[model samples]
Target: MAEKRTGARKSSSDGDDGASSRKAPSKKAPSRKTPAKRAAPKAEAPRRATATQVAARAAQQLLELTGKEAEGVTGLGRADDGWTVEVEVVEVRRIPNTTDVLALYEVTTDDHGDLMGYRRLRRYTRGTPGGE
Candidate 1:
């Protein structure tokens, strides 16, 4: 009769006893690739002021410097450095509204509507024809 073995059998490969011979999976972390850098956005140029804005700015500035009330804007155009605006203002008040003294001022302003300079072009009564 053959005798039965009571203990576990041994593995011949690594000379290990009949515990698991396979190694546990490694716990190492995965390596990551860095992202590429992006280019910076370009800046925009400043916008020029509109005719209406330039005219209004010129009138207000003339009033502040001359201490006279602006009556109206007669002419507006672009200049080499900025804008040229013609503004009418009351220089002297009179009993009759039509006889009041008025002046025409040429005002210059920058691209952003900031007044650079101003000069009186002509002066006449409000009743004068064509302001000549």
Candidate 2:
């Protein structure tokens, strides 16, 4: 899949001057595709992790994709990027499952806990506030 990357600016000010700033949303055009045979790969990979390392790595990976730190999130899992963490977030629309998937954001940082880049991949209700 091709990634459409675009940068957006979010104002940090909470001032309300009765003004609006918006742009027309861009729509992606769908293209026809041919169905391909579905078959599993016959190759296997070797193990390279211990139990403790696995859990710690999972938590770190979650912090990168979703902005939420591990402090407010739980139920981490393996995602395409590295991990998927669930959290109770208000930014997401409060729907049941499809809409309210408050997954932890992933962010890159240095030795210090300074945030670099982050984005959310998916949302789930597991381990959310009130235990979802």
lDDT of each: 0.83, 0.44
In the range 1-132, model 2's lDDT, one tens digit per residue, is 123222111222222322234344768778555355335454655444543445455456554554444645444344443433343343454446455545545433322222334565455554445432
The TM-scores of all predictions, comma-separated, are 0.65, 0.26
- lDDT for each residue of candidate 1 in 1-132, tens digit (9 for 90 to 100): 122222222234434532256675878877554444324445567788889988988999899999999999999989888999999999999988889999999998998789998999999998778724
Evaluate candidate 2 by giving its C-alpha RMSD to the native, one decimal: 31.8
**Leading candidate by TM-score:** 1
Stretches of model 1 off by over 4 angstroms after superposition: 1-44, 130-132
The alpha-carbon RMSD values of the candidates against the true structure, listed in the order shown, are 10.0, 31.8
